[model samples]
Target chain A: MHELSIAKNIIEIVKESVEEKDLSEVDKVVLKIGDLSGVVPASLLFSLEAITNNTELENAGYEVINVPFIVKCNTCGKESNNEAGIVRCTLCGSNDTGIISGNELLVSEIILKN
Target chain B: MSVITVERKILAKNDEIAEQNRELLKQNDVFTINLVSSPGSGKTSLLEKTISLIGSKVNISVIEGDVQTSLDAERVANYNVPVVSIVTNGACHLEAKLVQDAINNLDLAKTELLFIENVGNLVCPAGFDLGEEMKIVVVSTTEGDDKPLKYPKMFRNSDVMIINKIDLIPYVNCDISKLKDNALLINPGLKIFEVSCTSGEGIKEWCNWLIENVKGKYIHQTQLVY
Candidate 1:
């Protein structure tokens, strides 16, 4: 799965942060995974756990903040949370809508151990 | 005890490389398309058809991405076009760095359009940007009409959706209308084309649209240059 690569990417980012901040160890890594990001949180967490084994991040807990897919209808100026993952206006029935959120795949925070 | 604020994209490295590629392609006046699909969704077949139809009118090059083997590259080479194959070894998708490497091997000056046949997987490729002008997702009738709904991210991310293998529609359980409806629901702005690579059904329309796009890009570039 691509999550393996994503997990490795997260570790790389964390490692860079650690080096720059002079942190001893990582306690947890916080991620913001959106519904439309095409990433499965469980699979990504599993990959992180497996790869972090025997490494400095072995005991680091992974925190994923689930973000719902929301869209803003340009026609009606109505915002709707689309659980079905479709980008459509709920009120004005306009297809011309922009994604308000939900495509995020970012590392928001990293907790360092004392 | 301390929480470090790091609001950064996990695929920032890839995105950076992708942006570099976009700049590079723009400078070279090369219009690129990243073709993505399931393992057996006839991506190669569609490419073969596209090349054959438009090769005489325009200059084309190809970068074939596969987990292993140079089979697709060999197939594309039969058309006498400049082709490069990127064997990911075991990677599920083609990253921007890999594509950047492939771009270095092609003659972009002579290439009007570059077709990157991405590794055959709908999910992972949707997330990775290879600096293509557009991403085209191919879905065959045999895969069923629910593909768009099942893999909404691919449909949503793709600018163009090519419904391939329409020749098998009579035997398959897929409803073409339903598939279009589902895809349109996910992405209302998607440009769709239905084609049968074997029967040469809608290849002309696809090629005409492609040529128009290439010409449009060329004209835009010329305008900027002047």
Candidate 2:
């Protein structure tokens, strides 16, 4: 899927962050993936593993933090987690709601072996 | 062990290029749209219909993205508008960088409205921004009404939803009203249009909307320039 592309982007980001450092020193890459980010964590991890093989980052693992889809009601100001992925207010039943979170695809942190 | 705080978007590079594209298109005053849909959702047919209806009124250009062939580009080229095709080889989606490269070969100066037809996919395209003013998602009646629920990200990210192949509504199980309801549940602000690209139904309304949008943005920009 597109996870390969995403994996490549992650690798690029990690490499950029590492700069002149050895990639072998990196322990794990922490990622914050949203429910609605159009990414499958397992697929992305597999892709990362497949592409990083024989490279310095082969031993590095990935930690994914799944973010829930949350929307804020424009009418009643109610913030609710949408497990079903509907963009409606949970309290007021209004359609005028805005997404507050759950679309994130971020590389939040990187850990190194001491 | 040491932990470094990155706190950066994974697609930050792509987003940066997309922003550059947005600025470039904005400076050229080209109103562009990123059209997305599932495979065989009649994206090309809708494009053909839209182009036929509004090609003379507006200077149109197209960027077609496919995994293999330039078939869609060839079809669009028949309209005599500037069209370019990006074959991703095996990639499922089109990124902003690909679009940035594709635009380089086009005549942006003569283009008023540009359409970037993303690879026939609902999942991957939702996450990638291709520097379009709006994203239009097409779903045909044969695809069923629950497409919005199944692909909420695509529906949520899109500004407009075009329900194509309405001519097959009688034979298909899709409930148009339910489709709209399902899509609206995910995106309240989505402007919807029902059309049968085959029978020429609702094409005029969609073209009119496109023309008005092109005029609206250009007028606002020209006023600022003057």
Question: Please, what is the whole-model Cα lDDT of each candidate in the order they appear?
Answer: 0.91, 0.91
Q: What is the overall TM-score of model 2 with all chains considered together?
A: 0.96
* TM-score of each model, paired residue for residue: 0.95, 0.96
lDDT of 1 by residue, A19-108 (tens): 644433788889999998889999999999999888777888989999888999988988999855688787777999998899999999
Could you report the DockQ of all the candidates, in the order they appear? 0.81, 0.83
Screening candidate 1 with a backbone cut-off below 3 angstroms (N, C-alpha, C), the clashing residue pairs are none
Tell me the tens digit of each residue's lDDT in model 2 across B66-121: 99999999999999999989999999999999999999989999999999999999
Candidate 1 deviant stretches above 4 angstroms: A20-24, B219-226
Please state what fraction of the native interface contacts candidate 1 reproduces: 0.84
- Which ranges of candidate 2 are over 4 A from the true structure? B218-226
User: Which candidate wins on DockQ?
Assistant: 2
How do the residues B89-139 of candidate 1 rate in per-residue lDDT, one tens digit apiece? 999999999999999999999999999999999899989988999999999
